[model samples]
Target: MVNRVEVFAAIRRDARVEGMSIRALAEKHGVHRRTVRQALEGAEPPPRKTPVRMSPRLAPFKSAIDEMLTCDLDAPRKQRHTARRVHVRLIEEHAATNLSYSTVRDYVRVRRAQIDLAAGRRNEVMVPQEHAPAAEAEVDFGEVYVILAGVKTKCRMFTFRLSYSGKAIHRVYATEGQEAFLEGHIDAFNEIGGIPTRHIRYDNLTSAVSKVVVARGHDPARDRVENSRWLLFRSHYGFDAFYCQPGIAGAHEKGGVEGEVGRFRRTHLVPMPVVDSLDELNEKIREWDLADERRRINDRIRTVADDFAQERQLLAPVPVEGFEPGLILTPRVDRSSLITVRMARYSVPARFIHRRVRVSLRASEVVVFDPDKSGRTQIARHPRVVTKGGQCVDLDHYLEVLKGKPGALPGSTALAQARASGVFTAAHEAFWANARRRLGDADGTRELIDVLLLHRHLPAAAVEAGLTAAISVGATSADVVALEARLHLAKTDAIAVVEHAGAVGGAGSGRHLVAQRHLDEQQDVARDVVAEARRRKVVSLTERLLLDPAAVIAGLPPDTRPLPSVEKYDQLLRLRTGTDNHPAPPTEQARPARPALSVEETP
Candidate 1:
């Protein structure tokens, strides 16, 4: 409660003005003769010297603890010992029963610092820095936690901050992989409308640096063997990369972004965002970035946006053509019709099994492309799984395979996912149940699979509507489902066609009469009692069942012919001009002579 400096002043004043003896001053001020002598010598008291007290209990274990601490210098920084660990070890190993933990902790703290100092390690020395407009920027990834879909998930926050303006762009990703890294840069560049003219500072992230060539007396610039993809990306964007020295030495190289990451996290991401998906989290981050532009960092006179405005014009314009940030991969599909990408599995079409397919692994999605003479065509796309061993499967991808092994359909992971995602709707469940009950499981599931295959061509809504129509009519056949789905599609097409005809008819030209006649025909069909309810502007079919189900069902005649077989038509695909199997019809002149001779012989 008392100030030591004030006490010393009082003692010195009393000694001088009262002319008190050392004993008298000691009695009056509650001070010792040594303290009185110190006060008399100078107004400011000399610091008290710490006593070299002996620790009798701790003496026996000192060597062991010292050896442990000394050896920790060679161990990993994360694995090094703390005061509590040393105390525990002493209690467990040395059996120093009477020793207090505080005693060991105090000694360990002082001794560790001394040991580090002795080993030529000291606190880092930091100096002030100045940044020029549009000159430099820093890139870094910081860990962030979010409650995604009611589950606690760890995510990475990519921050790109301009040194001069303190203006930053932030995006959250599922992983800190090269795809996310490159995408973060692309997003920052596009958002800022330009790139930093000078080199950008970066830590030696594995995404950019494949190998760090650490050699004595070598330039840090050439020390890194940049990743080929990263080099190509940087070259496309027209920017230079300045890699920091590895480890602690490089931490301070990008201090601006390092501090920015923490500042943004503490200020905006404090509550640990609750989001349904990563895109939702990033949407929040984008809003925060915009709000931060109006803020002032530390004690600056101008806001971040104000400073950025002046710096914006100085920055180099973004390149006209942008670069693809997704990492390209080629993975062979297994028997399960799944391809493994970055330890995660995603389903492609069953036709691609045992075949290598090109994948563009982006931050949020994986795109599979099938390359042919016609060039690459995207066959499947799924959300990228964040965790290792995770899978993203589409039930439609394995329809053909499931058709052969209908027993596997009920227990398949893809089917489970489809049910979870509402892709397999109640109508589908109802239809499958009916089919299984009527046709038995094996044949019934095959029918369901056939109906499922229609989803590849028809809209899911149409297929779901078709299922409902079939269930209402007590139709267990996949053909009925296909026919209803096709009818639903026809209705949609008719509506579009009618609208287009109406627009064309407004031209009031003679040629418009054709469209008008088609429109009139469609109207006449709608007015007909048989098709009246089928041609209305309807809501989503998945949300509503068809009107007049009994009437439509009764109007449907029993189909004896197999459902629209195209198997025979496939032969026409291999059209041969002149082959023994199917020679083209002989010309009349060419066949006439042979025909005349054959007829005379027959007569």
Candidate 2:
């Protein structure tokens, strides 16, 4: 076949040459006579005609439509008049006579070409080389369905793409909360190796805008404006945000990211990815994303990885403190002497347990601080365990307090039950007993003592108040005795008070007041001591049985047992030794029983 460019060139040449017969040239060129005649005539081609009008009904409003197109060609397509709108405007505003709606519509259709030609604006070409590298980035989120731990879950996939480099990053998250949004940026920034100089473009995602800024201030006029409050996050992260006009127009600004999201889902997150855990799946996806850095782009000589390396040099360095995306709340200690943080329990030293403390929360940890202290001591730290209503101090911290305060052990049924369950050790019991000795038996004192016990886990300063309170309440040996008597169905307030005061104050206060107020308490303890000693004096068979029944029955053994008559045993031993001061000879020592052995076993 002859080339079309060559054929067109021949036709032009033949026309330029003077007078060869046009018909002969046509036959020689294997062209039609009419085509040769037209080429020779050098006539301007008649303008291409439009197809015949489908509807004559739109003819009357042709002039109005033409005027609208010419005046507001650049206006949004939605704002331009449709056939129905033109019909309405003609009847209402123009007050035109005898203009039916169908006639206006048909007229507009017939004049469509003329109207469009009049409306057309000149187009400008944007040279690609004029744009600099890292000028802008497009960001968006896509939805990805992933099987995590055998459960299908939907995740928001964050995508970011550099306009010039076409380098991109895709990340998946369970939610698009603020933390996740910020995290996605951090990841994308790292993947790109730097941030784009131009502001990021995005659709009006809720993460970016709380409310669309339709207007501002009182008696406001409606206009598109940046939502200032929502812009703070972008400012904090050191990025300018260019929000697209709400919906589809904005979507075009981030078209690169849209394509990247789809590509990532298909390449890295698709075909029903299954894994033992979500973490593992994410790890695999991250590896794939990193690997994409090495893949060469279609038109670019450098790989995405190489472009990202350059971008890294251009990006702002992350602060040494790094980004903290979780909400931080400051809560005072409740009257229960506990601070609630993230629905988990933690103990402050007894003193600050009832006072206000500051709570610092991060995504993973919650720290309670004693702001009153000069150094801002961390009174408690706990894993964040968000609950439905509110957080509780850790029960384990409270348990440690119980373990520290032996006296408080009696007040906590839970502690006592736990001890009874054989979970507590003998050493723990011993320690608790020692604490009870130091603190009095009063409920407040006991509670304080328990608080003091928390010092074992926290700081001693925390429980100082509990210790002082316990001591201030006449929690002496005498008070303990009074409490014991009361436990055994003895009620004597006067005696109890006197005994406690005396015990706490010591003999410096004299015994007279104590005797009058706590005579019964003192007498009871004395009686108990005497009774115990008397019981020890009256030895039962059970106590004596292990002492050797045969020896006791016959008479105490002279050598192997304690002598029933000490003087008699001493005299005999002395007589045998023939020296009152000398010890018995080694041969006189008692022999143990001999072992029986078989002949082969006997060496």
* Per-candidate count of clashing residue pairs (backbone under 3 Å): 0, 21
Identify the candidate with maximal lDDT: 1
lDDT of 1 by residue, 1-603 (tens): 777788889988887798989999889988788888887888886777899988898888889888888988799889999999999888898888898999999899988987887876666678889999999999999999999889999999999999999999999999999999999999999999899999999988899999988677876545788999999999999999998877887788888899999999999888898988888888888888999999998999999999999999999999898787888888999988999998999999999889998899999889989965332698999988988899999998988888888999999999999998889999999999988987899998999999988888899999988898888867888888887888787777666756665666576667578767777787556445235436542223321224566666676679798677864544574354333366445678778664455655775
RMSD of 1: 10.4
What C-alpha lDDT does candidate 1 achieve relative to the native structure? 0.86
* lDDT per residue as tens, model 2, 1-603: 876456646777866784567777787789888766665555443344699655453455567777765555667867876778777777787776567777776666756556566555333243343235677888888888877657776767777888766777766665665556766787777655556677787777766666565654632222234545346556665677777766564455566778788877887765878875444666787788778888876777999878766666666654444454544466666545566654555455555655677776543356677676753577777544433343434333454455456455455644554455443434334434544454434434454344433545443332332233223333332233223333322223334544565565455335477554465566567556545533532122322444688756676435776557667787888988888997644453575556999999898
Candidate 2: global Cα-lDDT? 0.59
Choose the strongest candidate by TM-score: 1
Name the regions of candidate 2 deviating beyond 4 angstroms: 1-33, 39-131, 190-198, 211-237, 328-603
**Model 1, runs deviating above 4 Å:** 1-120, 218-222, 373-375, 403-407, 435-447, 465-603
RMSD of 2: 23.9
Per-prediction TM-score to the true structure, in the order listed: 0.67, 0.44
For model 2, the run of ten residues with the poorest summed lDDT: 481-490
Clashes of 2: 21
